[model samples]
Target: MEILKGIVLLLLVLVGFTMFSLKMPKGMKAMGALAGAATASFLVEAFHFYVGGDLFGITILRDLGAASGGMGGVAAATLVALALGSSPVYAVLIGCAVSGFGILPGFFAGYVLGFILPKMEEKIPDGIDLIAVIVIAAPLARLVAIGADPLVNATLINIGKIITQATAQSPTIMAIILGGVITVVATAPLSSMALTAMLGLTGLPMAIGALSVMGSSFMNAVFFHKIFKDKSTTIAVAVEPLTQADLISANPIPVYCTNFVGGAIAGLIVTHFGLINNAAGTATPIAGLMVMYGFNSPLKVTIAAALCAVAGLTIGFIGSLVFKNFKIKSVAEVRGTV
Candidate 1:
């Protein structure tokens, strides 16, 4: 029952949020805000790791980080809502009221309130907009959060458990499945880092996911070399494919078809060699490959990653052949049409 409920919530949050963003005007703007804010929210940990500052036994730092993460969600939602034509101050206030859920859920919640708030403001008399926002929007937002955030958390926890079980029961097959899924999620508007964090995915599963994501990046760079045109753009997209979400999402066939192949190959190598990642969110090529340096011999890690890249390259070659049949629209053209 619990697993079923979690799956249902996962589908709702994933599908519902995806459709809302794609269908709504300026929805991608909101998604951009969420991504930026989510990365920024990790500043506290980043600082502690690099700078090593202490306030009230470092617990203060954590509290500050939590606050920043929460506010980041609010700010992201506000930016999107305002872009959708909500009033400025009201948008901010309502954004604050509505977005206590984590980044993605907060985005969906904010999108809903963004449309509704304008209608609500219109119904009210003059001179009391502040009251309306504070009294109505604030609590209503909390009410939404109370119901929504728990569902999201529950769904994430269940997903994590499933991955854990898979790794234990059938390592190779699970590696391919999870690797491909995580790679797609990472490249998509969804948060792969956040998903891994929720799952606490580490060891072999983490290694597989990291390799798959990196391999997919290599495949993308190779398959779209003409569009990328330069080393810098290719590298950037490899590290983070969200940079080209518009193009990738617009023409998903080649990218996804190749990614599945690359991901499976990477997964196979990681499982066969017993490669593992002790850390989470270090799933990018360099970061993912480097994490294994200390655990295994540097030579071994490099070879494993290189093999994954080779596999990705193989698929990219196949994808290129497949893509020859299509018109192969320019990235700019896709962006313009969208």
Candidate 2:
């Protein structure tokens, strides 16, 4: 109940900020205004922490997601989709299932169309138009649902029981393995980055992870993708808009590619150097200064995580490059997917 209240109150503040700030125009200055609004939201949340109250989502705002209603952005997206052409069931799936993570998958799926639209030539040729749209939507829908379903379901539904029972003891290896598995499983068809966040925090690793990335929803996806990588969305479509909004994607490719390298490093170093992060928030390249406070300490852990992050970034860059090389080109190419 308290968590619910905090989420609601915080959202009210966000709504006020958005209305006041939205009128400031649309370029960089508007961006600064948005940042200011986000900062205000950040302070309000911090104030909640000071009062010994839970923000219901301190990590989202405190890190970089702007605010933490957690369910609104995607709902807005679904509304837009409904207004566009989606059915009620689809809209509900998108709204309830998606969070900020929708950006990448949605963009990727849409990118297919982005590319496809140009070459389509005059009216989309009747019967093929609907077929084309459906084709584009399949990958988009799969990935979007996968990214949203788990996290949205975690504590809200009874499904987390499966994870809870498995990791009840909370061993370090279990945490790592589970983290890796959930992230991988989080791939389209049946996964959610949100569920991974809840599952990733168990007995031994709860504190360390929340401090490192798990705590902040912004950092969670950033770091997760740092490990895996995205596929469903091309960078051109997915990266531009949301990056403007300051949201990250939950695509597994980046997370897997990066985290494994970093985690492997952490795995080797965790026992020997006794790596520890006490603060509960996401630590990114910008958040590096928390060193004295013990984030990414042991140097090796930080280094490892960095290596992991770089690995994902590199892989994503390369995958994108390779695709572009093959002349796959933009969302217009086959409506954006195979």
Best by lDDT: 1
* lDDT on C-alpha atoms for all candidate structures: 0.65, 0.34
**Candidate 2 residue runs with Cα over 4 Å from true position:** 1-172, 185-193, 196-204, 207-273, 277-301, 310-338
Question: What global local distance difference test value does model 1 have?
Answer: 0.65
lDDT of 2 by residue, 54-102 (tens): 3233543344433432323343434434443455544444444345543
TM-scores of the models, in the order given? 0.70, 0.31
lDDT of 1 by residue, 43-69 (tens): 333233212323224665556645664
* lDDT for position 260 in model 1: 68
As for candidate 1, its clashing pairs are: none
Worst 10 residues of 1 by lDDT: 47-56
Per-residue error for 147 in candidate 1, Å, reads 0.7
